[model samples]
Target chain A: MAELWELSAAALRAAIGRGEVSCHEVAQAHLDRCAALDPRVRAFVTLTPGTALAQADHWDAARARGEALPPLAGIPIALKDNFCTRGIRTTCSSKILGDWQPPYDATATRLVREAGCVLLGKTNLDEFAMGSSTENSGLFTTRNPWDLDRVPGGSSGGSAAAVAACMSPLATGSDTGGSIRQPAALCGVVGMKPTYGRVSRYGLVAFASSLDQIGPFARSVEDAALLLQALAVPDPLDSTSLPVEAPDYRAALTGDVRGLRIGVPREYFAEGVHETVRTAVRRALDLFCDLGATVEETSTPHAEYGLACYYIIAPAEASSNLARYDGVRYGIRADNARDVIGMFEETRDLGFGDEVKHRIMLGTYALSAGYYDAYYDKALRVRTLVKQDFERCWERYDVLVAPTSPEVAFRIGEKAGDPLAMKLSDICTIPVNMAGNCAISLPCGFQDGLPIGLQIIGKSLDEATVLRAAHAYEQAANWQPRVPSLSP
Target chain B: MPRLTLAEVEHVALLSRLRLTETEKQKLADDLNVILQQFDRLQAVDTREVPPTAHAMTLTNVFRADTARPSLPRAELLHGAPEARDEFFVVPRVVDTE
Candidate 1:
């Protein structure tokens, strides 16, 4: 029999529902796994054992009384530290908010809690989700479960690692630009970022208002769909939250891909992509072709401009959103400041990491009096061009397939000092966010002991089709994602 | 080629409400110039006829009833503040008392 911690979310939920396993037992197994494994992975920033046990016992008692349970009841999950979990300290992994507890829960947090998902812990991320590697975490870097020396691609690195290592069966992540998918690809799990405004961002600490989205990390496509179903409801808290009903994500995972149109964008296969990654994605496409899904090479000409447009727009929005962190409120305060201006400057300088500072500076320059039209405005227009490229593709194809990241995870400090190289790590994943569409990354192949991610993109608000294609691929490929301990 | 000078870097830092050391100014200027060269590529692409999109999804004013609703308790709201007294946030003086 499989250990409680090793069971898939669907299996565990059924076991708990059938009274074969108590929710308490399931929650305890995950907590014990975290206690044993977290010292090596550093995935969790804070573990909520008391709350998890209480919630588990609550579900167990309700089941004993023969009451109907909510979907995803009693499954242990990890929340990225950027989410505001009321009473749990939500550090966006920055020194400024190191111990500051949020007064309210992010809508996604509230919905998952309402669904009875046990809280395993809050996972680490890059400071304010600014970098591609977890090395940017002000608390500590979360290592790749596959290779401890390598990064679990970030800014949602800890969530990806936690799910990969069985620390949690499901975890939530936010993608500004490939924060979820890139890490999931590197860690050999499934990560999906829903269409923009698909998930409410009420209490979510914003990185880039236009590009940021909350998503899920699971080991299987079915599990990703289940978790997303719990999180995809519209909320009045976020005005940008889509007002329409969320399509039934889990029910749509029929795993039948007959006649599904899969488009392989040409630019995603161009130079700079590792041969192994390209080969893995192409093979995944071939597998789709065999499964009766048609595959064709298409062109999205503006994808190369995504990096430049993203850097400009994301930072500009980040600079504005992060301005609220000034010392007058809930964050760290600098001592020995003579005035409010000095206080603000000193506290921010002391609080933010180098990456955060760099972005803030870039944004400040771009939004300044003389440079707004040249930098911020130009990026916005180019952003339209990037979106139009995808719009054109959607007119012809139901889904676009590519390698989630150009390369697999790199060593922790390999690109830490070189900004450009680090930024390039997310080149393949950033374009989807630029267009405000939906994308999912799943393990397609392995290279030298590291797993490769194949990305499937869908039209805006069409996560159902994306999951269907990925589910078909996962079922046909018959690949069981490898746990770190099983790795060669 | 230097795109952003040290003085410009410092000015940008001031606008960002962050203070940088002399060494930081030097390093950030170099980093900013590197990043700016990429942004400059946008100049080559003609966007004269393109209208900017602030969001990916089409959104309109979301209206909820104007009825009064219970809010978070004042004490609880103030609890997360760095320093608070009598339900008010404490901060450095804003006025010139000299």
Candidate 2:
């Protein structure tokens, strides 16, 4: 029998709902697993065993009293440290705000609490959610469960690693540019970034406000859908929140994708993709065809510009958003500063990592007075063309299929020295973010013992089709049940 | 496009309110130049007639009734401040005592 910690969120919720296991039992099993494996995985920045136990006990008591419960009631979930948790340290893996605790919960945090999900703890990420690898985390790097020497894909690295290692059944992650999907693909799990406004960003620490979105990481597509169902609600606090009603995402997973249109973009499979990853993704496309889906070659011509466009736009916005982190209102203050200018310089110098500084500098240079029209403006225009390219593609196909990353999980420190090489890893995933459409990355196959991700992208607000197609493929593939071997 | 010089990188750091060591500034100049060279590809596309999209979705002025909501309590808001003095955040002096 699989341990409760290893069970999927759907299975755990079903067992808890049926009284086969109490919520407390499920929570304790995961807590115990984390106690044992987290040191190896380093998935969490902070563990809240005490709070998790208490919440689980509350759910158990409610069940004993025969009170109605939410579908996710009693399920344990982790949140990336960027989301603000009331009274809990919400570090973005940056020392600047290492000890800063929020006074109120983010909208997503509050919604999860209302859904009766037990909060396991906060997980690690690239500092300020900036890097493609967790090595940028100021606190500590999270290792891949498949191989400790390899990275687990990042900004959402800790969440993906934790889900892959079975430390939590589900976790929340935010994607600015493939943060959720690339890591999910690398860690061999399910990650989805909803349409830009599908989830509210009321209290998510802004990385690049226009591109950033909160999503879910789970072992199975159904669990990913369930978490999205809880998180996809409108919030008055966030102006970008969509007013549309949240759909029954779980119900959309009918596991029958007959005649579904799948577009394999030539641009995504072009140069730089490893042969093993390309083969795995191509094999997955064949499986989709066998399942009655039509696979066709499509072109999103402007996608090649996605990386350049994102690097410009994201950092440009980041430079502005991060300007709030001066030494005044909250967070760390640099001592021994003679003036405010000196204080701001010293504080940021000590607080931000190299990647963050690089981005801020690039943004400052791009948005500078004379260069704004040349760089930032050009990137924005290219973004329009990119969105239009996707629009044109979607006119012929229901969803686009692509590799989540150019390659599988690479060895730690392999690309650490070259920032450009690290940025190139996001080429396959950034276009989806640039277009502001929904995309999901699921384990399609493995290459040399490392998992490869297959990304399915849908039109704006068309996540139903995206989840439906992913679930259909997932049910047929049966890849979600595979877990990494942690034993030496 | 001109390659970024070390002095240009230092100027950008000054604009960004960040302090970088001399070594980091040189390294940043090299790195930024490489990245900018990659970004130069965007110049090939003709966007003269295209309007720049600042946001993904079509957005307009979003407004709510002008009613004040309860804000976080002063004590709770100041809980994370590095230095506070009687309901106020303390910071370095903005001006020198000449």
Scored on chain A only, each candidate's TM-score is 0.99, 0.99
> What lDDT tens digits, residue by residue, belong to model 1 across residues A47-154?
999999999999999998999999889999999999999999889999998599888899999999999899999999999999888899999999999999899999
Model 2, position A454, has a per-residue lDDT of: 94
lDDT value, residue A377 of candidate 1: 89
Native A-B contacts reproduced, model 1: 0.81
TM-score of chain B of each: 0.89, 0.94
Model 2 ranges with Cα > 4 A deviation: B96-98
Tens digits of per-residue lDDT, candidate 2, B1-98, equal: 77788888888999999999999999898888888998899999999999998888887878999998998999988878888889899887766779
**RMSD in Å for all candidates:** 1.2, 1.0
DockQ of each: 0.82, 0.83
Candidate 1's displacement at residue A388, Å, is: 0.6
Please give the CA lDDT of all the candidate structures. Answer: 0.91, 0.92
